[model samples]
Target: MPCAPTLAHYWLAETLRLREALWGPLEDSGEVRRARAQGQGFGQKVLLRAQFLGQREKLDLLIARWTRGARLALLGMLAAAILAGAATAVGALGDGSRSVNVLLALTAMLGLNALAFLFWLLSFAVRSAGSGTWLGELWLWLTRKLARGPDAALAPRALVEVLSRNNALRWILGGISHGLWAAALLSMLLSLLAVLSARRYGFNWETTLLSADTFVSLTAFLGWLPSLLGFAIPPEAVVRASNGLQALPETAQALWSSWLIGCVATYGLLPRMLCLVLSLLMARRNLAAIGLDENLPGYAELRGRLAPPSEKAGIDGPDTPGFQAHFRPRAPAPHDQTQPLLAGIELAPDTPWPPAGLPAGVADLGIIDSRLERKNLLERFQRQPPGQLLMVCDAQQTPDRGTIALLAELAGLAGQAHIALHGQAGAGFSDARAAAWQERLAAAGFLPGQLHAGLAPALAWLAAGQPARPIAKDAHVQP
Candidate 1:
């Protein structure tokens, strides 16, 4: 059975499905049929199809690009937020020259933040709040911009569609927005504490139309929560006396400073921190529930192809013919012997290339896929034949006339050649396919000891510098 699907597998399969919808259908060289036969479920079949079609490498590239772009976008946003926070803190204190306007400072620090927080709260009631906050949108825009290419938008589009279909987009983006805001607020708090510790600044409130009692009441109301948290609250006298430009006593200044810090912490930082945690939890829960949306436009068509209905069958004609070994052994060709070479012929796209564990000096002529590549290899073999040639064939594919002929020709060029059937012995039709290859190669004059079930024996043969023992003339080959 195929392995369980992961988030990346879902993303890759969904992206490919969407691409098929946008572009025309992808060419299938029996991959879907093989996947249906080998895989145990819809998810596994989809993943198998992608692997057989060699889409994993493309998916890896796309994922790498997205990760790099996201990191850069995050760094950029963080730098901007830090700068903005520092600037806000500096602007609130106004160079520390005159008595700081406590009311104005409070408004400057939190008025916009409060408005933004209220908007975020209201987003829960809105149906189309998946657009998220401005910061989240900006991050997305920057990420896409940094990863610009022909296929750049495909990944992000697929991710958004997947998250949005599961109603996880808002929470995910909300978490990002809240986290960034929290970072900014923390930076502001730190900057405020640093500047206040270094400077001797007084705090006062002035109003042209409002009375001192109004400032006192407003200050009391705002400081109430902070006071409960051990932050100092200014007395009515301090609030009354600091209504002008006159410098206040040290006790009044200390109280005003504590109040300012407390209010910023209570109102600005705490709310963002709480929302950040909430968004993260909600996002995680929703994301954990996400799965492949098989009802999407392209996925509906795959159900029939990947899991077709069963049908009753009856024999209505004569039995088909059985296998017959048409052995036409001919004298092997002679050629100049050189280094040993290992090569793969028409292997599946997703099969690992230049496979590992090769002995020291065997030259790996990578997988021969196209006609030009085959012709080139044949010409190179003609010019300088290998002393021992190990040709790897995909056991999953049937041995056709062309493949048999090519194997024969390559065997004729090498001083001694061995054919290795490459695949798992227990996979669907693998044993039958391997037996077919054995019969075909034997018919082509390859000795029984020269046929290997897989690459390990071939490598062992190469490493031994020859066959382990002499083969009897009438010996039978085991697949």
Candidate 2:
């Protein structure tokens, strides 16, 4: 009703005012410090700060926020000026006032307003895209200066907490802001039309503006009333009424009235829902933007513990037999289950490695493989379990005789072992040989799961630790 441009000015000014009043005071004082600490990123900080502001003071904060918001009115005016100029240009481009010059101008103004509105909407989304209210961080993400960790798995609690804190008031204000933008755009268009009509078609500017203002104001009033009523009425009551109408035969009037009610609900509820969703998504992105997802180290100061062994040590390698005389084992707690597994090994071709070499009761063994054996082992164990921690000693791409021999030994040691190759897609072996080996393994009931593609992700996953069960059974694997 106030015209879109005027409304935009009002809302932008109001938002800035609210931000300054609510956030400014807290920032000035120390209350923001605690709030800041609670957040992982800028968005969280703003949300926490807002929550804190809500608790301490109310009226003064609101007034201050609006005071700061007044500045944005200037921007709204600039937008209005742009719209006016476009309207004039369109009027001139058309056959001057003789035909539909005035209408052309109005149409051009509307188009300009629409473009401006589009940009405003996009900017809103971009600014609020991160995990927190600190718009600056989101800006950084847009610019790609900061590379955040995976956004997909980030937690949503920070967002949820913020949205749930002051949802009703928050959404009301957010709707007002949106309405303001809409109004400003409309105002600019309306004003441009009035000015162009007066100049081109001898229409009275004052009368046109006054009439348009009255019409728009009345429309705004109607919209505002219904929206307010819908929001004020309990959601359950509306839902119940909607449900009851489902059983009744629909008259045209009844259908139209129901449709009107539905529209009211949509407009009233959509703003709140959008705000909540935007807040959450922005918070999530912000969290990732600030490295919140990383595994930060513990706070304990362990630098002293990591120093090299001093004069107290006899042989340097006290953990081994040659150095064992220098060190005495600390007495262990009877209940402790963390003792390192002691092991001894001896290898002979006559006997199997596991039974012949490995000491009984050893918890685990660490084996190094030659590239060939590693490749052969991978190929053999591709789809099946290697039974033991079979170290493949072959290059998966280039399988040699030595690697084949290692695989054969592993196959003997474990009845169901398969090779795990590490080679380029079509490099190491003849296609026929590779196909034959794959077919042989397929017949033997062994198949490869996902193989390493590039070195990094593969190594990272392996370093993180393998799944307890077969990869297919692992939740991390896709169906």
Candidate 3:
């Protein structure tokens, strides 16, 4: 797996592609224009571009753009950190008193920040703010600069219902937030040290309502770890002397300063640094899990272009006129149905699993993709096959030769089969892809009545098993 920074850089690159994908199939190049002219859709064009750029080139491009965006954000953060350090320095030691109240000065400098960190921890646990992460506003600005509006909706489809749906993106932003906090805390600590060196500043502690004993207990608690690290811890005498009732002697001032430094190191700087490291490790793990989601509409649509199966003419009859199929999205068929085995073959990215339309006994074989999954499905077919295997597929995906080949193979394995086109139907149908699927199925010896929209219709048709043609011997295979 790549390191945290490397993964973060790639995330920016993926975001760039996803943003451009929102623009749909538009292209300025003559080659792209020609591809579009030849009935190649917007998605296939994007895949080709990705291929042309190559993986290494894509990484390089992402690094360049990621660095530019990082630099802008870093510069802004640096300004904020410097300003904060300067303000806190002046606030901490600017008093003309020979001895500064250690409690009062440190609290003034770190109290609000500690409170803010606590609130941050609360928000992290809840994770309710997906799109509004700590750096979300900055990320949004960078997005707008990279492209125009990531429009509210894409009609037939949308970009992961907006970028926030990308969990990987949110995790990356979390790591970035940890890094920013670390920078701010470390800067504040360094600035405080620098200010102290410039003048003879005395540090003391004084609280009005609290007695000397109260502070003694508190100091002992706060300094336990610091003391273990060999840092000096003030005794009860020092705590009593800093009760704001009396000015401490010169020697006591140095002891108070050492105690204050120890508290800041243990409570402030070290914690932030530790959190930052943990965040980076988590970010790396998440990045390593991200893969090109081929199930997405964008990638699904490119099936034909990416893996066009070998042309074995007549495998599916040539005369299919167009890609349109006899499929439309309809109300879910009524529920009184004998359960047919359900299997989804790369259904659309948005299609819900354990499909909504089926009956109770429906066994979902999952979306078929990898060789292992295919092997499992085949094994199940032999183990306990259904009357009819309802193979679900995304209509938006062009039923390319490779797709048809798989469908044909699966159909041969089951006793009986049908194809349920999930996404592309009715108003959203694509003529070219639909026609291709129809011709392929026809040649594969699969017929209508054998076909339906989803589990709902497939079950309904099976329950009503009407005046239909008897299946060919080849159509009903032995398990």
Better of 1 and 2 by lDDT: 1
lDDT of 2 by residue, 1-479 (tens): 12122222222222323334333311111223334435554434433444443434342244333334333443454465456444444443344344332223333434443453354456546645322222222222222322222321111222222233333222323333444334444444344345444543221112324444453343344345555554222122222333222332323223323323333234333443465465455544443333111111210111111221331322221222211111011233333333122111122233222322333333333332444434343343333322333232222333333333333333433422223322334433344444443443333233443222222333333333342222222212110
The weakest ten consecutive residues by lDDT in model 2 span: 320-329
Residue 174 in model 2: lDDT: 34
Model number with the top lDDT: 1
TM-score of each: 0.66, 0.20, 0.52
Clashing pairs in 3: 100-204, 101-204, 102-204, 322-435, 323-434, 323-435, 324-435
Q: Tell me the lDDT of model 3 at 178.
A: 54
- 71-146, model 1: which lDDT tens digit per residue? 8888889888888887899899988788788889889988888887887777778877455476787787777777
* lDDT by candidate, in order shown: 0.74, 0.33, 0.55
In what order do the candidates fall by TM-score, top score first?
Answer: 1, 3, 2
Indicate the worst ten consecutive residues by lDDT in candidate 1. Answer: 316-325
